[model samples]
Target chain A: DAGVTQSPTHLIKTRGQQVTLRCSPKSGHDTVSWYQQALGQGPQFIFQYYEEEERQRGNFPDRFSGHQFPNYSSELNVNALLLGDSALYLCASSQTGTGLYNEQFFGPGTRLTVL
Target chain B: DQQVKQNSPSLSVQEGRISILNCDYTNSMFDYFLWYKKYPAEGPTFLISISSIKDKNEDGRFTVFLNKSAKHLSLHIVPSQPGDSAVYFCAASGAWGTDSWGKLQFGAGTQVVVTP
Candidate 1:
């Protein structure tokens, strides 16, 4: 089976521009979560979506938002992007009821470069 | 604040030997810990994990040891292979059934290089 997939392997945008990145969860998974991995650092949680509603979020600004469609695909949108917004955006998927012990499968990640 | 910390930025190990990667955390609330391996340009792949209630868990050539009292954990790879050379990340989460919902707190990753 195909694992998690993300769109736009790479992106480039200037400050104040809006960018949207997409992700498709692994087959048989119902939850989608987003994370940001800065260079030389581990990924930090951005937010998670279940049942098309945002269930939990991390310490991110309001400019960062996301949406989960009926098919469990997700889109992360960053508005008024800043130079620091550049990072590797990763999308992970897991079953809704698997809880914390279950493994989270990740996508290849989209490289966002803000100029 | 970084609740989880991986002090070593990089480690080199000879192939066919044991490779140990350590992680420490300050958050006592964290009850579940995990390790992930990532290659350049790719997202992290789940390696192994251990719960707070358990002291150790092993899978094939990989094993994880957790010390609850010290809030520390370690990943041991036996017969380390060249393909095992990658960035290893340590992550933790609060107890299940809480609002955490798999939102993991990760440490600065440690890069492992295995040479033949």
Candidate 2:
């Protein structure tokens, strides 16, 4: 079976511009989460979507938002992007029934480069 | 403050030897711990994990040991191969507060290189 998949392997944007990244969770999975990994740091949690509603969010600014469709696919939208927004956007999928013990499958990730 | 920390930035080991990567966390609420291996330009791949109730979990060549009293966890790889070279990240998930159970806190990661 195919694992989690993300669209637009890479993206380039200018300051004050907007960007949208897409992710399709692994088959049989229902929860989707997003993370941002900088140049030399580990990924920082952005937010998580479950039941088509945002369940939890990290400390990121309001400029970062996300949506989860009924099919369990997700989209991450960053508005008024800044230079610091440049990073690898990773999408991870898990099953809600497993709760905290579920192993999340991650996609190849979309590399966002803000110019 | 970093709730999860991987003090070692890199580690090198010979082929057929054992490689041990360490991780420490300060959050007692973090009951579930996981290790993820990431190659350059790719997302992390789940390796192994241990729950708070269990002190150890093993899967194939990977073994994870958890010390709840010390709030430390480690991933041990036996007979390391060159393909094992990558960045290993320690992640934890739990209901620390009102937060969702799916949220995870990750460490900076440790790079491991296995030489032939």
Scored by TM-score, the top model is 1
The digit string of per-residue lDDT tens for model 2 on A1-115 reads 9999999999999999999999999999999999999987888889999999999898899999999999999999999999999999999999987554757889999999999
Q: Enumerate the chain B TM-scores of all models.
A: 0.97, 0.95
* Strongest candidate by DockQ: 1
Model 2 chain B weakest lDDT span, ten residues long: B94-103
DockQ per model, Cα: 0.75, 0.66
State residue A14's C-alpha deviation in candidate 2, in Å: 0.4
The residue pairs in collision within model 2 are none
TM per candidate: 0.98, 0.97
Task: Looking at model 2, give its docking quality level.
Answer: medium
- Looking at model 2 chain A, report the run of 10 residues with the lowest lDDT sum: A96-105
Alpha carbon deviation, residue B23, candidate 1 (Å): 0.3
Q: What does TM-score give for chain A of every model?
A: 0.97, 0.97
Interface RMSD of the candidates, in order: 1.4, 2.0
